[model samples]
Target: MIDFWLAAGLLLLVALSFLLIPVLRSRRAQLEEDRTALNVALYQERVAELQTQQEEGVLDAAQMDAGRAEAARELLADTEGVAAPRVTRLGKPAPLLAAILVPVLGLGLYLHFGASDKVELTREFSQAPKSMEEMTQRLERAVAAQPDSAEALYFLGRTYMTQDRPADAAKIFERTVNLAGRQPELLGQWAQAQYFADGKKWSDKVQALTDEALKADPKEVTSLGLLGIAAFEAERYQDAIDYWNRLLEQLPADDKSRIALQGGITRATEKLVASGGQVVKAPVAKATALLKVSVDLAPDLKAKVQPGDSVFIFARATNGPPAPLAAKRLTVADLPATVELSDADAMMPQLKLSNFPEVQLVARISRAGKPTAGEWIGRSQPLASSTTAPQTLTIDSPDK
Candidate 1:
């Protein structure tokens, strides 16, 4: 920001020079005009003296003419190199006043309308924060500077949750939902924050939020974790085990939280056994969905497309979000090849194929390797996500 202001000040100085330089030059021209007038007066005085001598018979006509010629020559010599006086419609004071007002008015307008606060926020974020508190302060200022920024609000809410300010986190998450739409992940965060904010007591509003999130995305991790905690707190050990097991399945092998989550499941299972209740394991095979697809270029497009062009095979929910439930990547040369898209290939855990009842398969050919859009595309009819039969897709039509 300091560098930016310095550059702006330099530009202002350049602008002021344009207005000031002309005035300074006009002053120099005035001085030259005044000196020329003074020399002409001195020449007239010498001519008057010579005429007086000739009238008194001290000099003849020829000598008098010579004397006048010498006086005129001296006047011309004194004024020889002087430039013509400049004519200005606006005098010195006007340009000087303009020079003063240009910067002042420009600065005033810029302060009122420019993105200086955003610039400051950017500069602050470039440095590593010394502490969490300092980072929080910067995020708060960023949210204040850009109230409409959903991404900033989401981060601030997460930060508040880490700081144990659940009430603040809940409010920020609500704002985030309003600005960014009721996304499953955002809904899960909002529900978790609201649950903690209400002193760990469940409410109808929290229930609604969690239900909506899970309905949209069954594998929403935050909501799953939150429900497990709620069930445990309510002394429903079996219910806690169920929710934790569902969450555990969604986690990756390398996730640091997996150890703690496994411990939680074990604790829940032990408590359920102590209560003389039978523990029922969830059906693991039913939870995993896989689609086998054979993709190939259309006969008509074979001559038009390069063999090295990229091909994307993916499945998206027919009745849910536009995001792919599962996807695969290959090259055009690999066409007429078989590929598999499973829950393991899910773009997001909450958007897995097992979470949706029905989906559509799409195959696209793109020179740019982008999945969302491409030159040629083919789509299969809506089919059950749990379908075991092989599907065939050919890239036959231009992408709309």
Candidate 2:
């Protein structure tokens, strides 16, 4: 920010020079004109003296004419090198007034419209924060600077949760969901925050959020984990075990949270058995919905695309929100390659391929790294989500 202000000041100085330089030149020209006037007065006084001598017969005609000529020569020498006076239609006040107003108006307009706060936030985020509190403050300022940015709001909400400020977290998460759409992870986050904010008591609002999230993507990790916690708190040990076990399956084998999640499931089972209940082991879930796709660039477009440009392949529901149900990102260099999209690749649990009955496959080449907009695209007709056949997609047409 300091650097930004310094650069702005330098630019202001440059602008002021345009307005001020002319005024300074006009002042110098005025001084030259004054010197010319003074020389003319001295020449007239000398001529008057010469004429008086001639009229009194103190000098002959040739002597009088020579005296006048010498006086004229002296006047010319005195006024030599004086610049021509400039005619300034603007006068002195206009430029001076403009010089003063330029910086002031620029600052006033910038304060009203410039993104200085956002610039500061970008600079702050470039460096590692000293503490979590500092990171939270930066995120908050970022959200304030870009009120429509769901990404900033999401990070701030997560930060609030880490700080144990669930109430604040809930509000921020709610706003995030509203802006980014009710993505399964965001919904789960909102539910978790709301649950804790309500003193860990279950509410219909939280229940709906978790339900909606789970319905979209059954393997949504956050919703699964949150549901297990809620069930455990309500002393529903078997329910807790089931939820935790489901969550446990979603985690990677080497994930550190897997150990903690397994421990939770074990405790839930023990509690259930101790309460004179039979421990029912849940069967392993069936293989998740998967779609195999071979992606390649069309021959016509191969020459137009850079190898390093982004290529996005995804499946989206035919009748659902525009957000992709499953997605994979690769570089154009990786094209003519096969990739898989499944629940594991779901962007949002409820929006997963398994949840949607019909979906369309799309492949796009994007130079700007945005999934939604691209330079070229290929799309498939709607197909069943459960189709077992492999799909082929090519980027052949310009993106509209």
Candidate 3:
């Protein structure tokens, strides 16, 4: 901020110079004009003295004329190289007034419209925040600086949720939805916040938000998690377990949150069993098959794809239905990514990798965000699903 102000001050001085330099030059020109006038007056005075002497018979006409000529030469010598005074329609006061107003007007306009607050926020965020409160303050300032910024609003809403200010979080999330569109993740966040903001009671608005989110993406993690929490709070242990199981399927095996989620599922199961409700176990394969594949865009096809294009990697039985048994979705930016597909990643509960003996691996890049249809694709020859070696897949051929 010190440096910022110093630079601003330097610019103001530069502006002031434009207004002040002309006034200073005019003053010097005025002094030269005065000096020239004084020389002329002295020359006139000397001529008058010579004429008086001639009229008093102390000098002849020739002597008077010579004396007058000598005075004229002296006047010219004294005034030599002096410039004519500059003509100015506006007086000194005008330039002085402008000098004063220029800076004041500039400062006023900058204060009213400049991004000084945003600049300060940027500086503040460059360092790790000392505390949650400090972070919240910075986020608040950021949202204030850019009210239309949906990203800032989303982060601020999340921060409010972290601080347990659900009412504020709900309002901020609503604003975020309006600015960023009803994205599945944002809708789920809004529903969760709104549910808590209403004193932990579910409302029609919350229900609608969650429904819309889940309809768009059945595996939306936030919506699944929120629904599970709502069911647990309402004492519907079975529903909680079901919702949590669905979310568990969407999570990667190595996800950090899996442990906590599993614990929640365990609690819900205990409650169900204690209430005399029989818990049915999902069928588990005796030998789970895991296929590790590294996917990448071919160098020749790189120029034909966008970074945000969807990439779908899957395995389907070579002699079975076209539907993928296990699949993972990513963006082209995540290409050159190594992904593991197992029964846990099955598209349907009935479809599992262990059920298939021989499978073909496929990787496709789709600009239209579709998994089934794409512009470029790659495929691996039939291999045992239980193969332990990691296979490399490159999207180099046109999809047919």
Candidate 4:
């Protein structure tokens, strides 16, 4: 019952504040200006009262001293007609106002102009099959416009997988591989989809695709990574190291890639050591020629240069004829192409002429199907004999 009274009193006081607040604020301001006069008058009255009480033997001198000290330090207790709190209204807390306003504006602006509703769609995609169906239908329309679109089919499968529609995605992936012929990244995606669909079961097709990818391009980094994992799973320690080494070679020698590469290498190397096997290296070839190259373009470089555009770069060799990569026949369609010397376009390897020996370097950039520009960087070496051994050329050293 007391608690109820207290709560009711608090609410009543709050309800009365709206009518009393402005007047109370004005009175407080007036009190600040007139406080000294009022205090002095009160002190005078207290001194007179103390004297009267002392005369009647009520308060002693010590009590009077304490009273005066307290009177000097504090305002007198409020009486019935005492002025209310004063001052030109209190200042609002700017930080509190900003805290409320900031979120309102930020969320309002973000929804109005910042992010698309599509971002949410991707997040809750599993709940919305209709959106996925529409996306697939749109992709079908696009593929119909271009019958030979391998990339489109690949994208379609990826969309279906993202929506957790595995069966539909599997069909699309199967079709994409047939159209594109062979793509390592696409194959990886297909295998990954199957693994996810079957609760992480490994299929023979996965292994076959990985092998074919590595054969298609020795520098296929992702294939090398898959091969490394497979080799480790099979307890082929040296084979794992060889595959990881290929991946390491293709990675940039920066702090990020260096740390990851070294970590993988360390793992494989440790396993190889435990098995008493050596990590395999590329066979070294003996020759007395070299080529130097400086890249002027990067793969996936989104510049003004587009597909079917002419591209150019400079190269040099140290020994023989730069016959194969004619400067005028270079083009851009040969993606991820290396600069090496060639005799009538028959490509061969070479060293950097310092720490390694073996050179037959040529430089060429192709546009569509024809070479648009090229230049030999060093003296070329004539091909003497074909062998499995190819020397590792050091591209790190600059002419010093």
Candidate 5:
């Protein structure tokens, strides 16, 4: 922003100087024209006076001629015309003095008061407004200026969203939908605004519109993701999985859509398992340490999964799961259910508590149970050593 402003100001100053040059030149030329005209008139008048005097016999022809010549010479001297010596402004002191002083004055002023850091033009325009009234006025004016303008309406809807007036935003977006005719891209944009602005009440409507958008362009990742979200909200887990999984294929190799798709999978699977699953009692021990595992699933996700697959928690045979240790699962209400992995009991599954102080733990899972993705979480000791306790990570809920 600063660089842009500096360049702009320099260009403006140069342009203004160019524009001023013609006006100054005209003033100088006008000064010369006036002086030339005055000298010509004076010379003519002096010649006429000399002639009149000679005609009246007050002086001889030679005397009159000499007088006329003298007058002409005097006039020429006064006007610096014929036989005038050259005057050198290049050697003048005042102008040189002014040149030095002008720069010094400019430098002083700039150092004292004008070296601004603020890039003061439309930079302010880029900052979002805090007040809704100003936003409303601007939005209204923009929409009014171009009645059938899809972009204008879209801007207005965004403004409304920023102002927390989703209902109003919905109205504007509906209008935008109407204005955007059959242009699929524009229509998709309108539908997107409408979907978000409608908030979850019109889920079915959003679904229909987004479907239409996808039909127009199957590669619309944004609409596909939204459709997945809507489906999840509506409790259609399989359909949500389909939408997000399809969306994942359309995403760039390194994108969050794939992660989102995986997360959705984890969530659905967890819910289904928790709803009804058999639990074998694993005994607890006298000495125990908490294991928190950091799992990175699907580094480059090609498909979306929701909780139909099992996630196996494993630790390094010598260092826990590569990096992260194991911790308890977080409930949706920000509650952590106690999960103890080791104790001094025989029934407890081959758990060694005294093994690795540097627990390199990982959470591994699979897409279609083909292979597991276990991401490294650093040692639990640092988190355990912090002055402030780490918050429990809530899992698998949209609001969370």
Candidate 6:
């Protein structure tokens, strides 16, 4: 900040030179005009004395003429090479006043509108932060300096969440979403923070956020993990297991979190079995054949769609490429429809649904007939490809 001020001051001096230099030059010109006038006055006095002496017969005409000529020559020599004074329409006071106000007004305008605070923030961030608290403070300051910056707000919100200040984190995340749009990762973060901020209680708003996030990208890890935590807190062991399992599928094989998450899934499964819930052990992937799924548009979104819109039902490997392994297409009019996905429907011989251990079922309504992107979407939790139960997937959220 001090360096910034110093640079500003130096620029101000440069600007002042433009105004003050002219004023100083004008003063010098005025002094030259005065000096010229003084020399002319002395010449006139000497001429008057010579003429008086000639008229009184104390000097001859030639002598007087010679004296007058010499005096005229001296006056010409003294005034030689002096410039004609420049005319200033605004007068001396105006330029002097401008010289004083230029720096002052410039500073006032810069303070009100310039990006000095942002410059300071950039400088501060260049250095490594000493602690989490220091980093959080820097992020907060950055957000303050650039209120419309979605990236700054995102980092600040994440820092708040890490500090256990979920209420503040939730608000910051909300602002970020407003600026950056309803991106899946941001929505998932907002949902997680809002859930914790509300004392870990589930609400329709949080549910809606998580649903929208997962619909846009079914493998959204944050939403999956948050849902698992919420289900566990509500004592819905089976739900906890399903959500955790979905989240686990998104993790890498070497991720350290996978061990902890697997432990969580095991605990949830044990609780479910203890509470008289049926636990089915899925068969090996090579033995899996067909998966029957029921896809439907949500009632609230029914009016927002057209009957001719294409509904794409697909199964994708949880840990493989984004391309669907097996797919089926239908019109919106045929929704509330049942579909079967199997190795026979695979886009390629080597990408069969049975080849993957777990798959996510997606039902998307694309008005443009593109299967990869759509207006509305629904997704199922990661499930074994061998599961024979009819899966239900609802198109209840915006595609992104």
Per-candidate TM-scores read 0.77, 0.71, 0.71, 0.35, 0.36, 0.67
Instruction: Kindly provide the TM-score of model 3 when superposed on the true structure, using C-alpha atoms.
Output: 0.71
Residue pairs with colliding backbones in model 2 are 216-349, 216-350, 217-349, 217-350
Q: Give the Å error, residue 252, model 1.
A: 1.2
Worst 10 residues of 6 by lDDT: 279-288
Candidate 3 overall lDDT versus native: 0.92
Query: Considering TM-score, where higher is better, how would the candidates rank from best to worst?
Result: 1, 2, 3, 6, 5, 4
lDDT of each candidate versus the true structure: 0.92, 0.90, 0.92, 0.55, 0.54, 0.90
Whole-model lDDT, model 4: 0.55
Off by over 4 Å in 3: 281-400
Candidate 1 to truth, TM: 0.77
Question: Per-residue lDDT tens digits of candidate 2, residues 19-104?
Answer: 98998888888888988899899999999998999999999999999999999999989888887776768789999999999899
What RMSD, rounded to one decimal, does every model reach?
7.0, 9.9, 11.0, 21.6, 19.4, 13.3
- TM-score: which candidate is best? 1
Winner on lDDT between 4 and 5 is 4
- For candidate 1, give the lDDT of residue 381: 98
State the number of backbone clashes in model 4. 37
Which pairs clash (backbone N, Cα, C closer than 3 Å) in model 1?
none
Q: Tell me how many residue pairs clash in candidate 1.
A: 0
| lDDT for each residue of candidate 1 in 161-192, tens digit (9 for 90 to 100) | 99999999999999999999999999999999
Specify the highest-lDDT model's number. 1
lDDT, candidate 5, 184-254, per-residue tens? 55455555666666666545666677778788887676677777777777766666666766666555566
Mark the 10 consecutive residues where model 3 has the least summed lDDT: 278-287
Report the C-alpha displacement of residue 367, candidate 1, in angstroms. Answer: 27
